[model samples]
Target: MNRKIIFTENAPGAIGYYSQAIASNGLVYTAGQIPLDPQTGEIVSSDFSEQVKQTLNNIESVLVASGTDLSKSIKLTVFITNLSNYPELNAVFKKQFDGIDPPARSVVEVSALPKDVSIEIDCIAAL
Candidate 1:
């Protein structure tokens, strides 16, 4: 299978030893995205809802770099520090996916996340 590493200035740079995403065959697998600002590389906000939105935006950038978009997402796995943010997550999803068919997803509440951010998200999408 052919594979390609993906990167973009529109998203936050990888803070570790990993590419932002990888495209192989016809699908792109993205690394978990935090709520960091692409230019500043700093956490975008302390608000849970804002963090979710920024994380999703970063995921979208990676997807676009891999020649796909959020509408093509096949699956998503969300890691959040608090399950109480569930309602806010769903609300954001409703707005982001609005008319488009949303992808299959799993939300996992964890004790912590990198950078102590409230949330992180990763996705698989067709390219």
Candidate 2:
């Protein structure tokens, strides 16, 4: 099975030893994307909804880099610092996913995330 490492300046540069996403075997696996803006390299907004939007945008960039799109996403894993933000997160998610059939998702509350961000998201997408 041939594999390709995906990278793009449209998403936050990986701070660790990992590619932004990998495309192979008819699938693209994306790294967890936070709310950081790629240009500014800073968390775009502290608000949950805004953060969610930024994260999703980052995810879109990775998908595009891997020659895929959101429609190809098969599953999403969302990790949040607080479950209370679910409503706000859901609202942002709905704005994007509601219009189209989004991939299956699982959301969990974690004690912390990299860079102290409130949310992080990763996904598996078909290419």
In model 1, the Cα lDDT at residue 30 comes to 97
lDDT of 2 at 40: 88
lDDT of 1 by residue, 61-114 (tens): 999888899999999999999998899999999999999999999999999988
Instruction: Quote each prediction's TM-score.
Output: 0.98, 0.97
CA RMSD, predictions in order: 0.6, 0.8
Worst window of 10 by summed lDDT in candidate 1: 60-69
Candidate 2 C-alpha lDDT tens digits along 1-127: 8999999999999978998998889999999999999998998988888899999999999999898898878999999999998899878888888768978999999999999999999999998
